[model samples]
Target: MLAETARPTAAPPTPPRLGFLRGWDTAIIAAVLVSILVASLTVEGFASPRNTGFLLIDMIPILLLALPMTLIILTGEIDLSVASIAGFISCLFGALWSSGLPLETIIPLCLLLGAVSGAVNGFLVSVVGLPSLAVTIGTLALYRGLAFVVLGDQAVTSFPRAITTALQAKIGATGIPVWIIPVLLLALVFGVVLHFTGFGRSLFAIGYSEDAARFAGITVARTKFWLFVASGAIAALVGIWWTLRYGSARGDNATGLELSVIAAVLLGGVSIFGGKGNLPGVIAGVALLAILRNALQLASVPEDTLSMLTGGLLIAAVVAPNAIVWGRTLRRKPHTT
Candidate 1:
């Protein structure tokens, strides 16, 4: 009898390695740099120290809000109520101040209220198992309405001058806001937590497959609840900052800002569908949007045109990535066939 010939087993396929500087994050960073260069060259006053200071200060609210927004989106959830939370807190702060509460006391109370507002959304979405989009949309209207109930159409313009001035004060010779120091430090902390920690990894898992993450012992409900709470707290903080920076607290403060926050997050290469994004990209996206807005304003672009531009960018951010992936799949399918 003759021995049978042996057939070799096929090797498992290796996953494709992402090259350095080849990711969407890197592209966003590059775009930000190119945008700055182009705007400085072509747009008058864009690179002026005075305008630069205003630009950075204007970026404060969006930057601060986007930090928590990034994490929430990473877990496959949305929070349309963030801007309303900020507006509501601004109104609450004004009401409290008018009632003779000290600024120190009023600030904490507003933050607490913001957290409670977030908890309402959290309870509905995470605990009651409602869809996040629907829950947030409802809260968006609820919170904004509550803002008007709290402060009517009046604006409070009597904040302490010392504090307001400090908020707007620039660092020596650099034209950067003093507030940017703490904000950037906060951003660094978020970056570390999301990139290096187990909790951060769990967020990605939840986004990719909630059922699988729960099977692996991740507490999906608790995680999401805390994220909403954080989102609220941060939004409240932005409200405080916005009120102080402008020396006014009003129900209309930060109205419609949620659009910008979401737009920046999506534009930064974060998937609106969730489960994919990084802090650097989001930060770059924020910078790009701020720069473009600032440059366009200097170039005499109308406010309506700017709004249209932002809306267009938001749509492109959502569509472009998916289209790219679909196109690549189609190309590869022909080769396989």
Candidate 2:
């Protein structure tokens, strides 16, 4: 006698819970609020639309680079060569156009060059199994040196007037500069990718543990390689913007900018060692730095003091979180009887 089997019911799937904020995001948000308050209080002309427009315009490149910088850090890699890549691409675009290459041709070629640089860095790190720190540091020098080799002491100033005017022009209605449009667009795109996409989740997983992530079917090497490529491409785009805005390209332009880029990324909340951070935090970090710089300039603060302030902020950003993490770990230990 075959008895009818009892019907089985499946348990309902659990809803996802809200995740708590990471250290970097919290710090950046707080810093941003404080910066706004301080700027408003200290600088008489600080809250004007013109100053705000200038601040936003100046922030575009730094904010743009910080987007990919956040991703790279999240995936547990670093690219110290970004500033150099920017300089090199700037030189390449300028040299090509100066030598009579069409703007359309030079632009695509510059982007391709940046992508190749990133691919090489990715290969060195992933295929050759070199540490990112060592590889990027070496490439940083090599790329910047190549920039010098390409342009030497010469600068390129002659560019299409239309391109320059379009990029640097301010909008009449809001008084916001056109240069800031790219920054806003890229930031929105990256924010969506990081927070709302499966790829973003994969990045966090890979950042946590590459071997474990691979076991879970994530493409660690490929994703990381593409990450570097994207970073290179973005850096190149930043170079193009700089050339258009300044109407010139020099091998030394944006030199030592890597520090600020990293500083902005780290300050935004992504851990230096990897595995935690988000775009909102990074945007806040960028805003905070930009506002501080803008306000200080208005206050007539010395440039040297500003440099020192930034250095101190970077050090504190790196050190404070580690100290807190360690403190919590120690506190959780049970006392010996």
**Which predicted model would earn the best TM-score?**
1
lDDT of 1 by residue, 113-199 (tens): 888988888888789988888889999999999999988999988888998889879888788988888999999999888877878
Clashing pairs for model 1 are: none
- Name the regions of candidate 1 deviating beyond 4 angstroms: 1-20
Model 2, 1-337: lDDT tens digits are 0112232222212211122264557767887899898889879888887887778888888988888888888878888899999999998888998899898888889999988998888888777778887888999999889888989989999987988878757888566887677678878889888777878877877676666577878888888889989989988988887888889888987677777888888777677766667788778878888888899999999989888777877887788777888899999999999
Residue 187 lDDT, candidate 2, scale 0-100:
87
Candidate 1 global CA lDDT score: 0.84
Q: After superposition, how far is residue 52 of candidate 2 from its true place, in Å?
A: 1.3
- Ten residues in sequence with the least summed lDDT for candidate 1: 1-10
Q: 47, model 1: CA deviation in Å? A: 0.7
**How does residue 169 of candidate 2 score in lDDT?**
74
